[model samples]
Target: MSSSQPSPSKSAAQGPGSPIADAAPLSLSAREPHVPADRLVAEMVPPPRFDSVRFDTYIPDPKQPSQPEAVRVLSAFAAGLGSAPSAGKRRWFGKKAPAKATGPRGVYLDGGYGVGKTHLLASLWHATPAEPQLKAFGTFVELTNLVGALGFQQTVATLSGHRLLCIDEFELDDPGDTVLVSSLLSRLVESGVALAATSNTLPGKLGEGRFAAADFLREIQGLSAHFRPLRIDGEDYRHRGLPEAPPPYTDEQVTRAAHATAGASLDAFPELLDHLAKVHPSRYGALTDDLRAVCLTGVAPVPDQSTALRLVVLADRLYDREVPVLASGVPFDRLFSDEMLNGGYRKKYFRAISRLTALARDAKGLVAQ
Candidate 1:
């Protein structure tokens, strides 16, 4: 984990009244994570942050009745998956599509960011009566990436045996994804694989303003049929009782802290964003292996949509790992342009801001006053 950049000299830190620390730091830009297909499938379980979460651990906001109701319904749904499917029903290949399920085969938790939808979804995953291998959990992007890594048919064959699949941050921003996932889930449902998902958008409402969704109505409708929607209403819980995120520290402070902190990675913000563009979104998790805090100097607004989306994925991985972010220059709120903020992918951008802000709060102690 040696840095790609040179270590700041000890004299720099000792310079008349400087708070700089004198240790070398790791560099994220120096690492190019290679995630094999097998690893993608193996890592489909909940991210570290939610690995230990369970139904009882989700404290439903007393004011949001839907929160508790979601838990109750999901708990029952998990219980319904207690019986394993017969071996004959395990295979999804070379079979006629089974009869349309009499009722919804899945539960979709719809809510705003930080409403604990992910927590509840992961809780259901943990509560489900199945072995870890029998259950799978991942974000929508990861699911699609898995399909891309393993061809669509292979993806179906691989997941068809699972008793349950939990999808967090479900989205339909692209038409191809709508078609691919709808077909995949249909096969899974036919194989008796129960499903649970969480998203900022409801199943039916996904892709409304993101694309030419009208043309994909059939695919969208078919996808919606597999899930029963449950709405949870509440303020963004990340900042509900938390203080404002600390302002960006000085570049010297950020660099000093990166050097001082073990397992911390140092990078110029712009270079890190450029590095992200070259890495596939699915491998972003791997890009952060064994790292502690992320220290970025010259934080600024993303130049365009593609880069912003990549950053969103990185933010998600960092938040999933509960890694603190220490940065200089512009804050997370200003990371996207106003046009991007008002555009179709606004929810994704806002969620990134929320998560990054939380990580920034976690890094306040890294800055030397």
Candidate 2:
């Protein structure tokens, strides 16, 4: 397809730096159909009317620029852009423009998953219309695969022209990921781009076990020099979607599960279940209200690694300055039938739920679905 007509001025003897001029026209041949350079460019850069953009453009508060917390964050983020040596060098603050960050603002917003982590940064992009910039969305995984070869360079060019950079779901699940984040972020910061990211782990918490976490932490800590850390405390905004998740649980399942284990002692489990509920209230509420959906019944024991780790911590709390006594709660059911999971001080995180349930029998009370 043909590109948008060049501006009248641009149509004149084209300058060397013009993107159109730089691209050689396609050479069509009998053997193959020529794809337009403009088409290729179109695919690489998102349009203005994208779903993310439309969703992000609402200023939660427009007066004095404070409609939403994201707007406030954007204002703070924008102010930091002013002090950035690299951002200042571009002098983009005066004009609505996007530029690469040889210098980038690496601010990470870490918190529990599904806590509107992505939405908060998204709101910043939508609210910062005064500073027009290219906004792209990518998770840690997507970035990892693209940080090398042509991917990183092209992404830079596409995003650089814009003054602000927004990244979402910045999880660091692997060691190699931490190292690359450091190298790339260092480059972006040097280029002078203002970056805002959302994650479920604190910058200090990232790559906790990985070799590169130290470097990642060192690089990110410098963010104190620019973007300020703002903890967003709020309810999960996710369930507010047009089509919300199904109701947490069915009535019959709850009653039946409750009736099935009326007299069971909940003494086997302790605060183990409580903490997960505390830190992840909605998830926990959903879990308890609908644990059967994931296949569960009554008070089960903590089996496998995930529940086991939780179990050990609970055991410590219950037995704090006291004797070792069985606590109670619904854990995984797989532990009872699985001989492999029968005995062990070490908690294997990935154990079967069934095993955990068999162990839950020690509880003083049993809960229904």
Candidate 3:
């Protein structure tokens, strides 16, 4: 939800006199959210959309046996956490004892987008017996950003107290992330912090096409050792039986709808991109605070890889918040260029397109004929 204050005239116009004026639309571009370090750590729980999701609420596709099996395995994994030795569990000499991990201590859900991996990951987080503070959940980007904000040792001190750490959309995009996350997780595991993750790529294959992964095989392999890869095979559930996304609306239509809809945000796509660059990706969630819908005009293809990646993070935050997106100009499928779409980050781009399309569909009801 954007915190951008509405213009005085716009606010006055939307004042209590008229029903349409009772609620003012927001502008995403106008907000520059600054999140503090402690807030970031406190907000690591599952996004609101998944706040209440548990294993029982997950509806697995009958066609995909792997789907149901993922649920079963994850359920058992969460249960096992209750019995695992605590971080301070020690040997007779007052030294720490190695985790009695019968097998891989963590589980990795590897699947394409919309395969309910996130749902399962959140479910596991909720099912864990520890208090909310003892279990942490966040995206891979947020995890890395936490390290950036809190420093490696401080982040470990913070999260090492947790009994479980659930990472969604886990990825290793570069050698730096490869080394950072590998070292971080290794320390956490030694502290007896249980780990679980979900991603399109398997643990071993992470950063494959995106970078010279072979150069970091040792680090990558060390990271992989922390998790038991659980294969989840299924179609993207977002488009499984849904109709095609509605076509773009006219700018006038978008603007008009933004005025009529309470808490909706209106912005030109290009301006929004520029704004996102100024705000850290870690603050994207705060940037969308209280937003009902996102309305964009003059939507066009992203200019370059950096901009596209930033938009992907924004798209993810919006999707996580379940904020509808109403837009004019280009459709989401055309947001990325062919070269970018076919490049190493294709999976990320595709996921963004899928998520944005779903949000677009969610916003169709906000438009008027």
Best by TM-score: 3
How far out, in Å, is residue 172 in model 2?
A: 2.6
Model 3, global lDDT:
0.83
- 157 in model 2: Cα distance from truth in Å? 5.4
Could you estimate the TM-score for every candidate?
Answer: 0.87, 0.40, 0.90
Report the C-alpha lDDT of model 2 over 1-369, residue by residue, as the tens digit. Answer: 222222323422444333332222211010112333233333222222233643345423233122256455555665545433444335555643345433325555644333454555655555544334344444444355444433656655555555556655454444566666655665566556566776544323333443232333454544435444444443323322323312222334433333343111111123334444333211221122101112122345444444554443322222111221222233233323344343332222122221222223322132332
Model 1 Cα lDDT, one tens digit per residue, 76-194: 88887786562326343555544544677788776667889999989888998889998899999999999999998899889988889998876756677867787888877767788
Clashing pairs in 1: none
Write one digit per residue (lDDT tens) for candidate 3, span 114-141.
8898999999999998899899999989
Total colliding residue pairs, candidate 3: 5
The order by descending TM-score is: 3, 1, 2
Q: Residue 255 error for model 1, in Å?
A: 0.6
Better of 1 and 2 by TM-score: 1
Which pairs of residues clash in candidate 3, taking residues 3 or more apart in a chain or in different chains?
A: 1-288, 1-289, 1-290, 1-291, 14-21
Tell me the spans in candidate 2 whose CA falls farther than 4 Å from its real position. Answer: 1-70, 76-106, 130-133, 148-161, 201-224, 239-369
User: Which sections of candidate 3 miss by over 4 Å?
Assistant: 1-4, 7-24, 89-99, 202-219
